[model samples]
Target: MPRWRSRTRAERRLAAEQQGHRGEALAGLLLQMKFYRLRARRFKTPVGEIDLIAEKRGAIIFVEVKSRGHQGSEAEALGAVNSARIVRAAQYWLARHPAESGKDMRFDVIFLAPGRWPRHLINAFSAS
Candidate 1:
């Protein structure tokens, strides 16, 4: 009988999307606080989309942001990420920005859950 229980499928989907956007914003802010310059928020390529792109000390970082409703679901949220798709997207991004090709690049993930600080996993995955 909760209000959320009454939400239609579309409503739930919209709410999820909103939550995802908020998570990405929070993640970007976290990166900035750590001296990382944000290059893009949502970088979409023909292959896929990267939630965030950042740079620090001449290193390019491709980040995937994942959010969940409760604490202790970090692993579950991380499991949802498709590293291969993100890697392909990063490749496409690099093709357009040839300047970044020679820079040291890595993949990262920022996990978010209610009542917890953002968890930043650096070098969380690799393109190889």
Candidate 2:
């Protein structure tokens, strides 16, 4: 039985938001475990938003997180990511932190579905 089936539309939206926050927290932990230093969460710019920003080995990663109630949708999550928007946001972020400008940067996506292991796709897209 899907819990959402019992929720009203507003309740469902709230639940989804809460779930997304949980997913982002979990994703951050996972990235830390992988030796990525967390930089920011829910980073926003006039151009767009990035769910998480992390760095490892001179590479800055701009991540988009997608949470679902269903499993095995990592590939589908990729489809939900707006690479161009993220790139623009990353550019804005770097502009604010000039010291990071010379470092390598890439966009990534993290998929989190209940009761399933999170999937992280590194260097998922390029700024070009």
**Candidate 1 Cα outliers beyond 4 Å, as residue runs:** 1-5
Q: To one decimal, what is the Cα RMSD in angstroms of model 1 from the true structure?
A: 2.1
Backbone clashes in candidate 1 total: 0
Q: lDDT of all the models against the reference?
A: 0.92, 0.89
Model 1 TM-score, all chains together: 0.93
lDDT of 2 by residue, 43-120 (tens): 979999889999999999999888888885577778878888988899999999999999989888888887877888
TM-score winner among the candidates?
1
Global lDDT of model 2: 0.89
